[model samples]
Target chain A: MTNSQNNSSVVDPRGPKPRKIMSRRNIILYGTLLVVAIYYLIPLYVMIVTSLKGMPEIRLGNIFSPPVEVTFEPWIKAWAQACTGLNCDGLSRGFWNSVKITIPSVFVSIAIASINGYALANWRFKGANLFFTILIFGAFIPYQIMIYPLVILLRDLGIYTKLPGLILIHSIFGMPILTLLFRNYFTTIPEELFKAARVDGAKFWGIYFRVMMPMSLPIFVVAIIMQVTGIWNDFLFGVIYTKPDTYPMTVQLNNIVNSVQGVKEYNVNMAATLLTGLVPLTVYFVSGKLFVKGITAGAVKG
Target chain B: MNSIEINNLSLNFGDVKVLKDLNLSVNKGEFLVLLGASGCGKSTLLNCIAGLLEINDGQIYINNQNVTWFEPSERGIGMVFQSYALYPQMSVKGNLSFSLKNAKLSKDEIEKRVKHASEILQIESLLDRKPAALSGGQRQRVAIGRALVRDVEVFLFDEPLSNLDAKLRTELRVEIKRLHQKLDNTMIYVTHDQIEAMTLADRIAIMRDGLIQQLDTPKIIYSNPVNKYVAGFIGSPGMNFLKGKILQDGKPIFKLEGGWCESPDLSNYKFQETIKVEKEVWLGIRPESVVVGGEAENMPVNFNLEIEVFEPMGADTLVWSQIGGQEFRFMVDVNTSINVGGTLTVGFDPAHASIFDLESEERL
Candidate 1:
């Protein structure tokens, strides 16, 4: 190389140097993170291995060992033939039930809360603050306190022990936080945009549909992630509101895993447990980036 | 006929009166700029005209129709905001055609309007790009196009250039001025920048404390300011004032701390009331009008002052000095060889200087 090129290749004393991969700091940092990863993965490891083992091997008693004799019998049993009370049909019934509850509940809750949030953020009615304050505080109240009252109300509406009753219950409980998430997100939008929409000849519903709804995709994804996980995992409302035949996955999982039957099928229980958690896990993994971004942007601003 | 007229408009937020009994009128195809500092209600007034604000008491007429109680869209006006406010999820073409689609315009009409606007703005290549992919200037052009497609009789701008950098602000400012000329639509613009107001306005309304202080053509407002506030606000390196008193002896002389000079002949000078001796006044003169060096030697009115500093500004030099113990600065041609602490004689026309009553701050 020429003299100038040689000089350029030489390291400058003031500039940062590249770090070695095996540096003491990197070892300590990544070592601590690796330990954490193993700690979290252990239970998942046990679940998969246990579910693959037959009952006789499960009784041989090393829960974390890879199954010596692997079989798909437990998975098939979890899907079709395990008993959850008198109905011998397995989690498929409850899986489909959870699907029915989750879809409408997610859509209905997000639709109502987003519009409610838009109104609260932009349109100021008299005593709106009073009602909003109550709603926000209501989010902290224990669901148990309102359960009995909701049961009476649903009975009056003739949706008691019905899927719609549980859907309504999930939407009602989801309102406060979903509204807060959406309201905070919508307020971050410039006030001038709302005014511009109005000036463009949009009224209340027109602005919501044309302007606010389209710009709010990230927050909607965040809302969907929240509602899906929440409603899918909900056992209290499902147990209280639905008949045994209409039980959601969580309630059915409980009956299948813990019921005092002829014999406790541990492998089938582990497989069923893993199956029930799969929907939320899939949603979380798929929406991981947007979920983080949405929360960061939707964080409350003054 | 007037394109817009507001009479006796007032607005209040609780105890604070943001605008009070304000009245204004815009001739058809007129470009009126509302100029003020922050919180002077310039934007508020524009909002009222656009029907974005509900007035406490007033009548607003647009194109000879009373639109005081009408919705903003029904009032037949379009607006551009400082933030640009393009719908983020939409592409440039979608943003431009969104409102038209809402108004139930036919697809061909929407396409034609969008095409014409993009062509006029030279933003044809940007139609498919999302706002996130566009630069600030491109997003602003799409915003302006959004209003353009509305085809309204009046266009309102609320400090639309404030969010841009200086270079882009100037570029978009010229583009807006060109748009106004080509469309021949009445436009009302709001800005705190005096240069933007002075360059773009056909008639400028200078406001303070929620009131229109003075409304006139840029030349009239600049050359003949009505009061001390107007004189100080219109010019860059704002008008310099030497506190003094009017000496009505012999020939109406103005006496300052260091010395005195002949006051402009006030025989025909319009005064709200008759002038008297010992009346405290502020004598105001713009920096560019202050003559320096050889030009000062033959003046009928002059001051011999010591230069505290001289700034060489390429095109012209700004010389800072003190007169009567108060700081004063004046501009001179760049060729002048002046140094710090040097003495220079400066002159100005008494006719061009303004004398305001110190107590009321109004012109005498």
Candidate 2:
């Protein structure tokens, strides 16, 4: 607590002395935060560095050290030709598979969840709350517990161990939270708005498409972020549902990096890991602005 | 045919009966204001008329059509909500024209209606701005404009100006009244504010406990409330009541505090035909009706009382004093110089007073 007289810093005209950026308190505060940030970022740094380095340089130097020789060979191999058991093609197969799975899964799950949320918020029928309670409670249970039952059900439908089966699994697992997210967000909307819309001649689907959906873009973006990241990085359901050919990117990435028959090309594995994470990472960065704030700020009179 | 009609309307929220056997009718182009305290079912009744709430037992007819089972839109009505439910993502013009657009109206027709509404509301400049960009009063104007574009037979409002500040509320209140005058549609407005009710309504329905306690013109409801509750509720600084007994004699005098005040001429008063002597009653008088100082000399009943407290309001002053061992409030002109401890003669004429029965509370 340096007094204004003791330091060569500008004193605030409002009387209280403001902390200077170079003050001891700010130094320690920002210094500690920077340390924590770097601590979290160290692994990402290592991944990037490892992905760029040739194997010879990686072996010659420490993992944290700058590479003597950099190469895109590992990235090329990871993207096109890394082997996974009988397959020579690499993470690209799983990449495309994930795109196919994640796109439909995100769209279908959000579409159903937003509509479900709107209905639960505005329209009530017998047993709606009962089923909603069950759905929310279902979110808390471990996904592993339902895997076997889901497998049998998918099998009965003759879609087990297929891409559609994986898509169905993602939607089912994502429902509880997504529905709850949408329902709670939709509830905050003034009930009068719904009434006004109805009096303005909006029907159920009409209100949903015209009123609720446009008004809920922020929540939709949040839901998409959750579903994209959740389904993209999903390893458990992918392994459980789809075979190797149709396996999602995470499953194929895991198989490629952990394959036991060859030498552990560490650089290639890092490259493949970063490649697999690229989709969700891109989504997060692109929507990162709307993700934090201002989506629903002026939507209602505060 | 009446513009809107309700037959045997009853609504229940589970076991709680919110509205009971309510029946009402409105003439075309009449502005009806339902005035009540919170949870008095005034808003519920408006919702029922708007087809927003399902009545457990009732038939609602609009324009001679039994629209009880029809969807709200099909009933040819538009409703404005308390929250000013403008579609946030839409501009003022968009919010006004959304339903028209949804109805697949032609582009020129939709644009024409929107322009007309904007011009009517004096919001022509705010057309391109979103609701979030407009001030609260402007947003409400757009909300009204939304309903105005529909050209419906009936317009329902549920405390549309409650969210604004007091100054803005008064401004919007006058604007809404003007809207009603210009549109000449059957408007059913619900509000807890007596000023809004009194100023805008052609007929005000005062409700309590899910029933319309009194329905009449504002002047009548003010001058002659139907019951003790109606008298107590309709005014600010509400009506003061003094408990006394009416002694039926040669001239029929109201006996209180060993003094006999002349009974009001009741020939025009509507009540039970039977008159009883030694019957207990309560005399109600509005704050403004209680004459003070030199004014009391002209009234039928006059008394000298000490002012307990003097509150100087800007335009007028409210003086509180005790009369017959009961606290009474009376209004005086701001220019009337008065102190808390000063004595002033106060009086009220019986014709301007309401007398209610002690047992039934019905006016006599």
Candidate 3:
């Protein structure tokens, strides 16, 4: 009993040893991470501080400093009174326009792309490989090259410079990458599951809605985050595709900042930029965990 | 009456033929097992019958109706898969009812069928549990219940118990057998495990290289396999084969190639055709058929050979030895005193052995 007690009392040396709190490796790793984080965070800090300050205070020009007298005037003006073109109304209209474009575009693109992905992954119709190859190839082409042709096509169709036209463009442009993502994700699901669904009397739409759709919530969240951010922050497409009245938030913000006629109120510009960025930020934070889960879901076997 | 029939079925994947000219007829209320190694097209054949694959050429008839062009849902058959393909997002009840709801069955009918299936599968308490929450065996039971709720006339199982542990596999095997006896539906099961095939099947169709080698009752397949491949495949620890030649003396006798012991008599062995003198042949003897100790004294073919290895497997022990310079194995009771390097007398009745032609490998 004494020998057993002595043996039990002795510390085992087989496991990991205790190390200093500030080891060199940890210091290097954490210090590098902290530095990189601050590098990305400092611009966001400046934008927040600048957006809260008045024009005179911003003119003093210490962007790194916190606001001495925090005010909501610039935000209110940015939301209701900033002039983009002839309209003196603010980013609120642009925000609504962005919302309209994003909601429909995200839904429409996801709907079409998910079906296309399901067909490509599960169904073996003729020429499917060719169709998938063409779709994936479209993802690699620069958007700038397609813009002129699309403009001409939309003009001929008589929907040019309209929200519907812009919505159509965003939906079409989002398809190739979104379809590829969904296809790869669907492929990760067991083929037996698809076969079982088929045997269970679920046809194409039935399986898609009931079985595939329910199991694909993570991918849907990922797709929503992707499309919302892409369409909301789009400046080139929004400017070229729609009139100033229907301009998305990104285009309206550009017009407010670089009007080339009035004294550029930097605070109002910063406030408009912050306001324009808020939608995508809110979406990311709301579904951030799901987005990560979606990305890594296909990496491991279920 | 035939419940499922395949006429000249053929499937190709690009340039490679996966299944070639396959024809099968499953009887009503019969349990037929498609047994083969991986890539032998057993699961592929099951898939074809289920209408899950578009066959390159075939006519599949179910319940006297041609279902070659019909959708899987229209074929009146339900299938279970190796992965227990229950909808991971839904509860067991939802999984069982999803297809019924699609079929537009009345709410009361759907509930009644779901209750009946869950009761039969003993998963009534797991109705609200998702597949992810259940253990593997429970999930598989739910999968079977999903198929059962459809009230299909035929059930196809594709290695359904493969994903479970050995103990669970045995338990579920009995459950599946019990389910079949209760349902009395035409069932086509695909498995690589011979023990499962033997125990559960009314008839076993052993396949190799996209062709059916033999389709017979398990006893016939075990005792008189049609080919060398069937003989080699059906038994655990496998049948022992000795390369020899059949010499026609006053009576038929098998001469071992290495001539290590006295030749065994083949007078009592049944031949499929007239035997040729001095023809190359393979003599196959099942390990358990070879008797040891005092039991060997009464046998026609008896020999004493030194044991090289012994594996004690509870009730029986498998002893490996060399006869005629070729490895020979036999099973003895575990209580028997057998050790490596000990000489032991072992013998088998020639009637129980199989003789195969050397070049054709066909039973002779």
- Top candidate (lDDT): 3
Q: Tens digit of lDDT per residue, candidate 3, span B1-364? A: 9999999999999998999999999999999999999999999899999999889998999999999999998999989999998888889899999889889999999999999999899999999988899999999999899889999889999999999999999999999999999999999999999999999999999999889999999999999999899999999889999999999889999999998667888999999999989999999999989999899989998889899999999999999888878999889999999777889988899889999999899999
What lDDT tens digits, residue by residue, belong to model 1 across residues B1-364?
Answer: 8999999999997789999898999999999999999999999999998888878888999999999999998989989999999888889998898889879999999999999989999999999999999988988888889889899999999999999999999999999999999999999999999999999999999999899999999999998899999999999888989888777766677777565443544444455577888888888889988998888876667768788998888899988988767678899999887888788889877677787989999888
Interface RMSD of each: 1.0, 1.0, 0.8
Ranking by lDDT: 3, 1, 2
Best by TM-score: 3
Q: Candidate 3 DockQ category?
A: high
Candidate 3 chain B: worst-modelled 10 consecutive residues by lDDT: B259-268
Question: Clashing residue pairs, candidate 2?
Answer: none
Model 2 regions more than 4 Å off: A1-19, A23-25, A294-302, B247-278
What TM-score does the first chain of candidate 1 have?
A: 0.93
Stretches of candidate 3 above 4 Å error? A1-9, A12-21, A298-302
Q: Candidate 2's error at B228, in angstroms?
A: 1.4
Stretch of 10 with least lDDT, candidate 1 chain A = A8-17
What is each predicted model's overall lDDT from 0 to 1?
Answer: 0.90, 0.87, 0.92
- Candidate 1 segments exceeding 4 Å error: A1-16, A300-302, B257-272
CA error at residue A278 for candidate 2, angstroms: 1.9
Summed backbone clashes in each candidate are 0, 0, 0
